[model samples]
Target chain A: MSKKLVEAMADLEEDAVLAEVKALKAQNVPALDIIAYLQEGMSIVGKRFEEKEYFLSELIMSAEIFNEASQLLGGGMGGAGSSKYGTFVMGTIYDDIHDIGKNIVTTVMSSNGFNVIDLGVDVPTAKYVEAIKQYKPKVIGISCLLTTAFDNIKECIQTLEKEGLRKDIKILIGGGPVDEATCKYVGADHVCKNAQETVEYSKKYMGV
Target chain B: MKTNKELYNERLTRIKKAIALEKPDKTPFAPMMDSFCARHMGYTLAQFCFDVELSNKIMIDSIKDLGEVDAASGTSSFAGGMGLIFMCRVKLPGRELPENALWQLDEQELMKPEDYDTIISKGWQAFSNEYVATRMNVDFELLGKTGAFAPIADQRMREAGYPVYGGGVVSLPVDYLSGGRTMAKFMMDIKRMPEKVTEVMDIIMKNNIETMKAGLKAAVDPIDVFIAMARGCPDFYSTKIWEKFVWRYLKEVTETCIEEGIAADFHIDANWERGLDYFKDFPKGTCVFETDGMTDIYKVKEKLGDIMCIKGDVQAGKLTLGTPEEVYNYSTRLIRDMGPGFILAGGCSIPPNAKVENVRAMVAAAAGK
Candidate 1:
């Protein structure tokens, strides 16, 4: 039954996942066990996404289904599923309103049992520094889709360094304009092409 | 060491030879003129886009400053059709959004799943009119104005002896539906019902073929139309998905043009390395594969250079931000690597914000200046 639940999540069948979670709860399966099954499904989704078999839409849909299942299971057990993969703070930097990529990274991160705080688009550098102080996340990701925002990304890294927050957390940058050159220019530790790669890097960072 | 006319013909010959996959003395340069005209005259994009006559005048006048080139400038008529743009919910720079912001199309599913049956049966034009009425909520006046600008630019460019390639504005069904269904929803639809998607694609292709035939009849001989495949790259979907949904329709469109003896030049946007294997299928000497610099043009040359003509590799980022020397170096590198069939151009439209000197540098480098 747990394996079937994983399959449902992997298939991105939101309704099927909800029904399976409900059945498992009714049958007295441990909430932790259900959460484990969902994570396994997420791993499969990640693999498919990395392999180019699945795309951004499928990755997002799978995350939504997992969210629904987690909520259903949590409601029955009187608590939410706990994330052991640590925390992440991510956002699209200032002057750039694009967020589809950032949102996908957030979903993938959260689905992989990482607590993600999505700061949203057009985020100021100061807000990032503040979020870092407040959340103390293990990872900080900044996204910029526009060529104009390249300088702002560099400014963000400089701000982090000035605040002495650069040493504590790993910084990641991603977007259409961001390549290896931009990554190096902005002084980011890593450049992620997509959400799947971001999740993989986060897993390795968290050493899980 | 040539007069403007002599230089112009020299460049045209180089471009023509390259398109035919024959070796030329030098690589030809055809810069993708997007917003460069307005900026050249120190006018806002809003001014350039809305005033067709003014934009045309600026393009004609600016060619002297823009230097010797095979063709003049052009962009999608977003300005000429502001009413339709707003009605269609398409975003624009300095108008519906910010002054300096780039114009963009909002990828919302303006059409729903049930609309598929209507499109399949009602046909493309009827459904297009319906879409304008329902989705755009406006009459065809603005859209007509937008289209009207194309001829003025085309006529003026030809009269000036710098013939513009009418990037044949036909979208494959999947590409067309991508706008209506939005990319994400359409992708989902493809996954959910491949058969239904294929059915609609057949309708779209038939409509597109008719459009192509009409265009061929309207234009003079040496009929080359730039196929706007900007959103048709393999990056958005898997290779298999691209084959199933995009390639079949694209092949049909290409075949229709080839059978009619028209040159089908393709303006393919985005990185299409994953699907470069499919380019081998296109009939040789009949098409020019114009790229937006995201794909490795050199890699493509190594893979499919012998099969079809290829042009591009200058990036918008480099043009907008990089120095003139960088532009010169990149242009020279493209010429050195893929010279014979190469037409020097941006991998995509030269962004409106491109520096004048940089634009000049690209043209100069192409001319071996």
Candidate 2:
């Protein structure tokens, strides 16, 4: 049983993990059984990405494997055995079009089961407001690859303040040219250290 | 009587001799390529970065703009559009631009080898396999050009007062961090995982080699020009990083260009200071190192000597804000200092929105008027 747990968590193979998770049902596995199994794997991958034990390439690979496993779990769930979730809206601000980092975060979030809306690049403050009004999401994720567009994040915050929505939505930022200082200076509530941290933080913040 | 090419070449030689701190025909004067000058001549920066017809026109016009200078030149991107993401609107004064974060599906993960093939083969090779070059004759010219490029997103740095157009891969943590992120990670990796970082840099070098290899073979005139192929300006990269990561690899690429009989220049946009020793073993030829801002061109003249020509050092910010006469005076001073082993140019990429007439006057000053 210990070996099975280790095998389940240590396996970075997408289909193999999914197969193992699926075959557990044939053996009359409990919901707690699969949840506990997948959660271990998530933790491992997340830690690797965070501790610098993994590269973006490997982190991405692990996420993909986890996604495959997630499909098996999401589909096989009985009505009472449902997972709780959170939503994140991500994008680059107006006049700045850089998305590699944010896109990675969005993928991890969606695969990890957060409802994520990607407002494509060159987004202005108004669009972010409109999205928040529509989604009423608790978290707003912003990514910028250019220093010039740094203001967009602050601009969005200012806009939210004007709309009296600043107190409600938490802002999260990450990207090549931005950092924790930028996150604070730009007035974000939180900033993920990297992809895995993005998932872990999103889960914790999302109450998932 | 000395022939015109001989006369031109001799005049250049004299400037070269003077730059060597030897006697020569007074000082060498040369003007760099400029857009605002072209715009003042009625061409736009957008038109300059793109349309080569206009770009070539501007290049030729620069000769007339700046008089009897030694080596005349400037930067224009005739073929650069890969990796950068820009969406074009075919409207009045149409603007094509990079899309924001929403358009990316990068996932900070492995693209699988198959995706790599798809991306690498995006241009002519794929286009040929998919669509016959039907536009070869009249049909081709009718279809306006579409090019792929590493996306050039714009920016305004914290220190920079205004939003400036700048782009060249940044914000890639996993890409960078898979090695070691913080100083701690780097030190730890150096002690424990020497092979890991070396392997990563090796991969980077290989990619750079292949990329530049294709560029070397891409027989086009403007491309015969290698821009920013200047890494390791000392300001952005440390001497350690420069020695370890940049130097050898650039040497190899530059060697390949030299072997190919192509003209290449290293465009350094930062103040490199007295690190001339770093570029010593770089591929030798008529290799030119282009700099912007307060790069001591005279010192560079002494250090590199005639080994490699220095290209530019006109401070763009100062030039843009200063008077035409001030521009002329500076141009003259630089000409005297730089002599023949250099080309007069903007210290960096000329801002898209710079004064035109000032640029023209600076050019005239370089022509020995």
On lDDT, the leading prediction is 1
| All DockQ scores | 0.33, 0.04
lDDT digits (tens) for residues A18-82 of candidate 2:
67777786687875667556655655654555554543444445545555565665632111122
Best candidate (score: TM-score)? 1
State the lDDT of candidate 2 residue by residue for B190-257, as single tens digits: 33344555555455445544555564454222223444432244432335544554465556656655
Residue-level lDDT tens digits of model 1 in B190-257: 76677988898888778777877787777633436667675477766666777888888788778877
Candidate 2 lands at a TM-score of: 0.48
lDDT of each: 0.72, 0.51
Clashes of each: 4, 27
Give every prediction's interface RMSD: 3.1, 11.4
In model 1, the runs with Cα more than 4 Å from the true position are A12-18, A25-36, A51-81, A93-113, A118-134, A151-167, A184-189, A194-197, A204-208, B1-12, B73-88, B137-142, B220-223
